[model samples]
Target: MAVTGISANRLELLQIANAVAQEKNIDREIVIEALEEAIQKGAKSRYGAHHDIRARIDPKTGELALTRHVTIVEDDWMPEDELEEFNDSAMVRLTDASKRDPEAVVGKEYVEDLPPFEFGRVQTQMARQVITGKVREAERANQYEEFKDRVGEIVNGTVKRVEYGNTIVDLGRGEGIMRRDQSIPREVFNIGDRIRTYIYDVRPEAKGPQIMLSRAHPGFMAKLFAQEVPEVYDGVIEIRAAARDAGSRAKMAVLSNDSSIDPVGACVGMRGSRVQAVVAELQGEKIDIIQWNPDEPTFIVNALAPAEVSKVVLDEEADRVEVVVPDEQLSLAIGRRGQNVRLASQLTGWQIDIITESQDSERRQREFSERTTLFQEALDVDEVIAQLLVTEGFATVEDLAFVDNYEVAEIEGFDEDTAEELQARARDFLERQAAILDAKRVELGVEDGVMAVPGVTGAIAVALGEGGVKTVEDLADLATDEIRGGYEMKNGERVKVPGVLESFNLAQEDAELLILQARVAAGWIDASELPQPPEPEYEEEGELAEGEYDPEAVFEDVAPEAAADDAEVAEGDLEPTRDA
Candidate 1:
């Protein structure tokens, strides 16, 4: 094989390049290009940085050519100060060039063949680095291009080794990493163990290709079911959503287009054989096949199966569900370490709060009593009218006041006169409440920009003021979640203080818009400007900064006043309570 040697041995260089290209699975031309670069680099180092030198490899016969050239100049083309820095070989007068090449003209150049360079230790090392670097780069490029399209596919490989608790798998084409957390919990694998993993991500890195593999990923389970069940593979049964705890339990919500086919049963297969196969592969992770339902309440009930949900109440505005079950089934519904409810929440994409039947009844009664009392106090009505109002979906004075008179007249037992009277009273009560809230807002020193925010009703403004959100600047600094619900700091914990959501009944969208408006008002972002791309992720080092790098560290000494605008609120802080 030809190596990167002198002219006699240069004929074999093409053989060396071919061997490298085959071994690295790269183009043979790429190897030749690397060799040319390496030779040129060695020549430059042996000569000088300013010398114009080039090396080329013969494509057919593996011959080598090394050349140095100089332009024959009629006049100086550069400034005198810069001209002094130019090398003598860079340009020569036609008179002097004729001494070397008698046919050389003013516009033309003189060329000389360079002698074969002896490969010195340092020069050889540099050449090797250049060649190796180009080869590795080409290999990484091949790896990236080969696997980028394979993401989300189940791949088969053999476990190569374990390092830092992560398993490295040698796929036939490339290597992949299964992060410890991405692997099934407590599942062990030895070197040479055959493994099937979900290629969840393919990221290009400075070092090489990063093929992220996962056995615990929900996609893995879904792919397994697809592979094991022909119905799923053929698209008879569609997997809607999947949630997994990895080696413990998983829930897969599926739907079938054909009315005759039962999606869950199809996924379960004959006597659970198919699911058991997936389970064995997952190290005994129990699988739940659930039928997808269009109705969210029905879906919630289905997701909380086995324990049998008795009732499901959804707060669509909050995207939260309250599920009530039999008292004995509470633990079962919640599962060990709340795994069942957690996976259920993930499957349904709604925050799930599990409660017992008895607790549900108590909560209903408490809400009923609170609304009734609020109606009686705010409208100056009797308990009968209050009860009617509560039963008719009038939860607050704001609700009654903001409602149209026709809506009030729609009450079963109420006539137009009575509706008008009730509405007048409700309006008056709201005006009084607003005046009080305005005073409190002013007294508490709320900023106008925060108050002007759409979701910051007079009462919510009072709450924000009390929470130290005193300026538009403060509001702008808050996260979108903070604007919706205030958070609180207690015992060095976030504690998730409620914000405008409860007080103003703001939706998540409302919070986002309100925060955006605040950002514009406080000059955080322009009203017409689109949000900028987020900064890239960076690693943090403790020794890099002398002090104050820890985000949570500041929370240790944070006083009530130091809490950010969206950063402080105890539960129910934003809930309206009528007090002068």
Candidate 2:
């Protein structure tokens, strides 16, 4: 066959392979393989099977070269005999081929040069197919390599196509998918529009690398901050936490290594330029930049910024924070639909309950108030009396009912017979009060029915009762001064009783018991049982001299005289003493 014009060259093929490798960013070997396949297909179409043909091009010159296969056979019935005879001289006889292969069989193969095959349209068409397919494969590989390392980074691209609500972005080198779920809601895009997104994921697919982009992920905010904040990029500010309700709001907590630099201000930039840029990218989603705080209370306060926090109480064991805010700021602190507090909780990994200042104050007042208000609809006088008795340090009405007549007489304005008669009434009151208090306790589900009485001194107990130290538990809740004042009572025109403080010479344990009794009486304790007070010691006195009158006689003359008419005092006629 005669050689055709513009013959393909090996050197040109090498140069084309190098250029393709560089242009496509693929291995040279890939281009080389494509070249070889193209050449083989072209050669097959150019030359018929009559000649065993192979093609080669000169590496230095633009020249095509070809080779043909010739067979050496000893007999006419050889494999070469089956081919259409080109010419009898084309086949080499066994005798002449013996020098090359002494053991040559009936059928033998050898290579010889043939004239370069002519370039034809059929061969060119075949080569084009091979080259196109190979180049496409190389381009896909190059695209994959270009984007694999870029996953989780932000990128800008033009909208190439939209299908099924997804946007296919043209990233110059490859296509990236912005799925419907990842796209901002209510956003519309047309071809040729420029868009920015986070490279959320990259995966190798059967055809190419699948590049996925997102605008909805929480990390997108972090990435945006990294891009806009120099401190973040330089490692001076670190994003400690982030939370987002995509297309609506996002919160980011940042910490700074340099004390002089404020992490929040750094991220916010001058006049809020930096964060505004991120918000613009997110399609008007709001951004909150907060300073990260190790103290949970401080962190919560920062998280709920712009609205002031009056107080934050943390229940560490419960992982919850109770935040108090001014009544006027409560709605602002809680935000619209609780968005502010929700984001703050998410940012700080805590459950936050917001309470208004008025609510808090009312709750505290209810807790520490001295008077107990019985529900008017549920009123029972016996119940009231029972509680009053318990408040007076008697755990059970039995203690009150067992008081002797003399003891009752000491209570003020009762004669011996009247005291006895009142005792009988006291028994009935005790039974009724006990039943009512126990029922009320059960109704209220009070686990600790009542606090034990604090084992305080008699003087202290008397003072506590008169001073409104009503319950054993109440005594416990009182401050030291309150407890000390409770022990001193008025004596006629003067207040002069030894209180717990005056009994300091007692043993430490005894003194503590006295304070404990005050605490119990204050209703600070819940247990019914209490430690008993120590027995009083008795000291015998020596006999006085014959002329010395008893010391008791000195104050006897001052005692008030009994009513000459023996008039009975009314049960409810007790009046406030002048000394009191």
Candidate 3:
């Protein structure tokens, strides 16, 4: 056999493999494997043989060779049996035997020298197809491996194509997908446009590497700052948190490990160059860079940039903050449709409730006036009468309502008849007030029901009267059990108190609710202080017999008519004294 065509010597093949590896930035071994596979396929197709074949290359010399595999069989076996043993199914057995002892096996694999035959036109075309296909597959796999670890890094890419508003980016070695949802609103991209995006994700697919890139992610802002400011990438400054409304506004909270470095100033850059670069990338999306603080109020104030905060009322328990701004700056602080406050809340991880000075002042005044009106209404008196009662140590309506008519009349310059009239009027007024409260309950959509008996005690009644608990229905809804359970302080210390609900004679439900309200108003109890109530004991026999009721009084003497009449006269005399 004679050789034909260009002879690819060992040195030439090594040079070719090295060049391919360098150009594609792939391993030399991978390229060599690809080339050997291509040559084996081409040789098989040219020879038109149906046998197992594999190819290998010498690492030192880059010498490529192909071997055909056959199975071992007995010498006495028939030609048909030998052919069957040498078929594809028995190739592995033959190869194993050849590895152990090449001379002992008759149908085992052997180094056969084939002629360096010239290929026909069709065979040459087939060889070219195989080589090209293998090279392409290896290149794709190499590219995927290179880019998989590069996720979350910033990359500059050129727009290769646009389909359904998605920008296909040419990242040199591979392609990246920039979906419409990952882009900022109102931002446009054209074919061949060069842009910078963050590699948000990387996934391997059958076709090639799938790189998901984005510009709208909150982390993208932090990454941009890191690129622009050296302090952020180093240990000096750290981006604590970031929030974005994409295209409209964004907020970032940063902290500095080094005391000398100002986190905000570092991110801002000299003359605003660092932040300006980020803004330019975002199509001028507004960014408010603030210093992260352990104090929530200070952090929130900083988050709401371009607006000065007069005061911050923090509700630490609820994770809420009420920001008080000047009357003139209310709109500025709140921004268009509350965007500023909303972004600030997101940045600080706290619910921000914005209020103006005028609004807060008006709210306080209204609450004070309502308290005064409630006191007067509760005492069943006019404003003047209520004021006088207050001056006489009856500060609350409960105090005045519980006082007797004789005691009211004993005050200086108060006539007896006038006092009686006033007492009657006060009782009538109490009834009317109760009716009004019931009406208010109806108006406010409270459930209609009878008040429970257990919820009506002196202290509870007073609390109810002060808190506008005028109706029996209100008493039934209170939670007496919780108030009875008491509460604990922030220091984990238990508070000593009679039941808040029991004082008002509230029923189980009413007492519990009232206690909850008290806890809310006073801020004395955490959620852990509440206790579950025990199940009530049920009585089977509802009533006691007359004989059974008198076990302790079984030997007492009964009174006669003359004695009873005398007793009644004495009681009547005593009633007049109480009345006077």
Question: In lDDT terms, which candidate is top?
Answer: 1
- Please provide, for model 1 over 89-164, each residue's C-alpha lDDT reduced to its tens digit, 9 standing for 90 to 100: 6777767777888788877855678998687787788889999999999999999999999998999999999998
lDDT of 2 by residue, 323-378 (tens): 88999999898888888888888889999999997887776544322222221112
Q: Which stretches of candidate 3 lie over 4 Å from their true place?
A: 1-16, 46-50, 59-62, 71-113, 117-129, 184-192, 269-274, 306-334, 349-580
TM-score for every candidate vs. truth?
Answer: 0.79, 0.47, 0.52
Scored by CA lDDT, what does every candidate get? 0.79, 0.66, 0.66
Descending-TM-score candidate ranking:
1, 3, 2
Count of steric clashes across candidates, in order: 12, 20, 21
Stretches off by above 4 angstroms in model 1 are 1-4, 9-11, 69-111, 442-453, 467-508, 518-580
Q: Which model is ahead, 2 or 3, in terms of TM-score?
A: 3
lDDT at 403 for candidate 1? 83
Best by TM-score: 1
Candidate 3 lDDT for residue 443? 56
Of candidates 3 and 1, the better by lDDT: 1
Q: Cα RMSDs of all predictions?
A: 13.2, 25.4, 19.9
Where model 2 places Cα greater than 4 Å from the true spot, the runs are: 1-29, 41-123, 294-338, 341-580
Cα misplacement distance, residue 200 of candidate 3 (Å): 2.4
Candidate 3 lDDT by residue in tens digits, 235-268:
5899999998888899999999999888889889
